[model samples]
Target: MEHHRSISDVLIIGSGIAGCVSALTMAEEGVHCTVITAGERLSYGNSELAQGGIVFHAENDEPEILEKDIMTAGWNHNYAKAVRQLCALGPDVLQELFIDKLHIPFNQRKPGDWFLTREGGHSLPRILYCHDHTGRNIMEALSKAVSEHPNITVLTKRTAIDLLTTHHHSSHMDFKYSLANSCVGAYVLNEHTAEVETLLSRYTVLATGGIGQVYLHTTNTPGSIGSGIAMAHRAGARLLNCEYVQFHPTALYAGKRGGQRFLVSEAVRGEGAVLVDSCGDAFMKRYDDRADLAPRDIVTRAIMDVMLKTGDDCVYLDAARNIKKDIVKRFPTISERCRNISVDITSEPIPVVPAAHYFCGGVLADLNGRTTLERLYAVGECSCTGVHGANRLASTSLLEGLVWGVTSGRDIARRISKTEPMSEKLRDSIRDWVNAGDEHNEDPALINQDWATIRNTMWNYVGISRSAGRLHRAFSDMRTLAKNLQDFYKNTPISKPLVDLFHGCQTAYVITLSAMRNRQSKGCHFRAD
Candidate 1:
């Protein structure tokens, strides 16, 4: 196979907020960066689908107070150091990067005063939003800046096939004898050209977002199938808390509306929306004292229990009677989407169900975004910094991504300056991606069936509630499916769908195995047995 090589100071395998932020931070310091996305559009990802808001410092808000809220939501399972770093430096980073540098027009009460809103798991109104389209607005600004920046190169429709580790990809046998493994770059598949390119860099960052798409129902973008996690796992990066998959309590229930569901922002509940039965009877108060304000895990489980007991397909989110603000104006995006499905948020209740939303577990990384592997960093949803712990706090996802993006970018810039470039011999030792079988052997029908089996198995046996029996069955089934997919993957031509299925299968197996090993019912990893 012929090889095409591209070099950069940094290679970021995502185009979301974290990727964009990291690129911008490094580029400003004269470091060249290459940002790639599997999606056709640079702005398409889980970050673009975010609606609730990003956490900020509210009036009289202290780092300790925010830390307490986060710990409470995470059930005291959070890494105290990571939580401390985020709570202390997050606001400053937000101000410097988003406000001062990017000039993102976040909503304001008046000049000099920002419009802060609350969300589930937050103690106060400490979230900044751009109407109900916070992620969209933030991405628009970041993507534009990244595209125009002279030091940053944006590549779309490029899927990362695997991380290029010295121990794994090097043609030299001596590299295998080295005590430590270092990531040199990645083998990326260029969709437009149908060719795999060797993308080499001094440093590599994985900002690839959530794993929600692995489930049957999710509030994530289509490409979020745990590709980054699978790639990192293949490279032997340490993974933490792989069982904690957070399910959003209120995804609009439009039956058979593809895999991606329209998320009813938690800000709606923060604005006074209440979860009720079909008969308009409020039920959250029965589950927790905080009722609608409870952490996502509690709320998601409560909704599931309600559904199981009542034998209903979905529950109702009554925003019409509770929220005093004009629903249309305050949540225009929600209103518009709801309207498309013949549901009016201003006058009626929204049919809602819990859907796979966020993954609290991922490749282990530190506060500076350094993973266990040398020269490889992970930020955003893909990296488990131990900040979110067993469950994520509402509105903290964006803040976590932002804080780490800036820190990782700055750290990489500093490290790269002192680090020597890869030697010509070492660089040449990295082998090109090879095709193992006939390109025409890939069957789309078989791939789609495999995906369906994985999704259905995950949703049924490993979803909101789980048991020893269910998890055991899930592990058995996924283990078999993963092996089959691996075999199919080796012999099939590398297409985007084929690659996604392979990654998805591997990720599903990881999550299932993790779920089976942990017997405790904590946060999102609720083991009924």
Candidate 2:
């Protein structure tokens, strides 16, 4: 095994909004940061797929109102401090970063007034969008800024294998005797050369996004397989709300049960699209008085119940009949995507189903994004700040990522200036990655099969609804699968698929275990028995 080493003031794993914001924020303070991602492009994550907009301050809106909406949506399980921080700072950060700094072309009603839209859990229309392609537009501008920044280095096609912690990766026995476990950096695999590089940094941030890919059907990109959570958990970081996985209520259902599902943005429902059964009977009113505007958990269960009762695999979103706005103009991307499948949003209903979308729980972190482990931080969907609690309000994902990204970045920069880098002797004591298997023995077929088993197990047993029997069976199956994957990982050469599969399996075990431990139903972690 060959070894290459690089050092930076800050190391950011995952190039989504959170990672980019962290990098840019620190870089502005003269900190040289390295941002890495597993995908070929920096824009290949959930942030880029965010069709809805981010939260902003609407007219006559108070921070307390937004806080109440968030707490209500989260079933009062939210961390009040985190919620308050988001409501207080989110709009200002959005204005400073996206509006004033980047000058992103968000939709505008006039020369001075911006166009705002509503989502499922909001009290008013407070989301700022760029038509329906808000994320694409935001990522495009943000990635460009990151690429051009002299203090930031963007490395694509780099997969983070694991966190480098003193308690685990240190070669010195005496260092393990210390009370604290500190992370120095990570072992990152360069996909182009298949070489593991030791990326040492004064501060390491895990913004690796969500765990949607762990389920059979999801709106997340293929890369979102809980790598960050798996790495943090292995490094002894505390995880919170692992059982609360939020399923989006309306994913475009094309009669498929697996792979990435096209998301029917909740903003569509906010625009008046109603969920109806095959017989065109509106059913959300039966479950919640808010009907189409119910929170994601309520909407998802309603859709599921309707599907089960009607013997239908999917329901329909009738935007054509309800939304008075020009459907094609308001949602050009959705219209085009539906057009490809011979369903025009302007004329009829679009087929939809529930799919895994977001993870409200993750590696426990604070408002500053600092994890339990020293010198390591987590932001974005990968970190549980306790803001989302049991379920996330629509469009808040992007805002949380942005706000925490800036906060974490500023916190790291402020601290890094006074702290010295790791000593040479201590750095030298960290060992490099060593491969134990024949590189030729790696089989794509086996990796694919393992991933399939993981996704199917999560979706079937621990999905939108759960029972004790289902959770027990899931735990048993995942336990066996975890052991098998551990053995396979030890014997197989490193690859992107292999690393993702290993992480996915570990994450599945964590989620299932968390579900089994909790007896009461709260938000998204509903138990049938």
Candidate 3:
């Protein structure tokens, strides 16, 4: 069959805030852009799951306060320049996304006051919210905007399995044309159509979000398979600090099979939700004087410690006592989800457990969101832009995505003028990949299980706390899993699940490798070594 996909100016591999913002910026520049997304379901990316809301300095809020809080929360190791830049740019990005383009219906106090709320780790009320489902609000707005764009094509349910490259170019003159050397585009697998297609572009942006799904128990969506980071690593992009994983303090724990729990928004705590022990005693005050407003790592460990010491099934989140029944009416979405599970926030405490929530590290990128790979950009939770070092401040992931996404897109658009479109040589390499896509065959089902193995290994060894011994064990487990996955992937027929699993294997090893390098306990990365 003849390949039909024409080259785009830039092919972005996600549909969340980052990818959408990138597309918006690129389209304005008249750079033809295409976004290849994880699923047809809108806002399926982690951005839509962010309940804490986007952190930005309201005009009334002090900039120094936000900066100090972030610096202190991230333990001072985070990149000051990037963090400062992000913080400075936060309001602009927020305005661009929420007010200028997506038209998110932000709650307001005085005509146009972005009714801000407070979350853990912030000293001031700085988060802009839309009821309780902030991600949903933002996602809804962005989806509408992107779908209407003429220059931007949003390809849903298409996973960028591997980046198209020529690291070892077919022609000597091509000289390592690669996502590693320089991105040509990506090999995307469309799940609904069951066809593998080669997508070509001058720039390929990986806005693929977080890897919290690497843990057996996590708050991330099923799509958070670490595909972008894993593919980027294989394409020879530099990765950093893959070890640091953040655990949210309170997920509505309902005894899931993998101990997986539904995310109860940090905004609950931001809205005065209290943490209580097994005996129904308010306990966060005992752990940290800041109480419900403590940083996520501290909050997670505190809950875990209480659970371990009391030998209880889980702790309780007790907002029923302080928060109003009427406000619960306002947050009907969250209130009802909890109520459906028989945990009425108006009368009883919700059973809570800590679950892996965010990855603080990933494929390293610069201030402009440019990865080591030329013409390849990344934003959101997937790229370690150093704005988040060992830990990320609440609501900052989407904020970072907003700033870097726009910046990266404009830069790529400017660079597109000097670069040639997808070459015949590059297309041939991608053709070979797509041809190999049809040629090879192996057990995809077994490859799927390796993903579980990776999740189990991370959750067991490199979870909320870690030690040299545990890390070593994790490395061993990761290696074994990787070997099995590589063998399976090499021998298997090309499929979306297979590609995702192969990515998982690379992610596990990279995370383990990054974990083994860091020796101190700081922020999300806790180590006894």
| Best candidate, lDDT | 2
Q: How well does candidate 3 score on lDDT at residue 386? A: 83
What tens digits encode model 2's per-residue C-alpha lDDT throughout 346-381? 888999999999999999999999999999999999
Off by over 4 Å in 3: 1-5, 176-180, 418-431, 434-448
Q: Write the per-residue lDDT of candidate 1 for residues 48-149, one digit (tens) a residue.
A: 889989999999999999999999999889999999999999999999888998888899978659999999988899999999999998999999999999
Q: Which residue pairs in candidate 3 collide?
A: 166-177, 441-493, 442-492, 442-493
TM-score of each: 0.99, 0.99, 0.94
**Which pairs of residues clash in candidate 2, taking residues 3 or more apart in a chain or in different chains?**
none
Candidate 3 lDDT over residue span 1-529, tens digit each = 4445668888888888888888888898888888877887557888887776888775567667787888888888788888888888888778865787667887886666667878888888888877878888888888887888899887878877788766732343455533247777887777777666778888888988978777888888888878888988988888887888889888878875663467888888877778998778887888888988889988999888898899987899887778763657556677888978887788888898888888888888888888888778888788988887777788888888888888887788788877776666566654535343343655556655666678888888988888889999999988887886666566556677777777777777888888888897888888746
Estimate the Cα RMSD of every predicted model relative to the unseen true structure: 1.0, 0.9, 2.3
Q: After TM-score superposition, what is the CA distance of residue 232 in candidate 3 from its true location, in Å?
A: 0.9
> After TM-score superposition, what is the CA distance of residue 282 in candidate 3 from its true location, in Å?
2.0
The TM-score, computed over Cα atoms with residue i paired to residue i, of candidate 1 is: 0.99
Model 2 CA deviation exceeding 4 Å by range? none
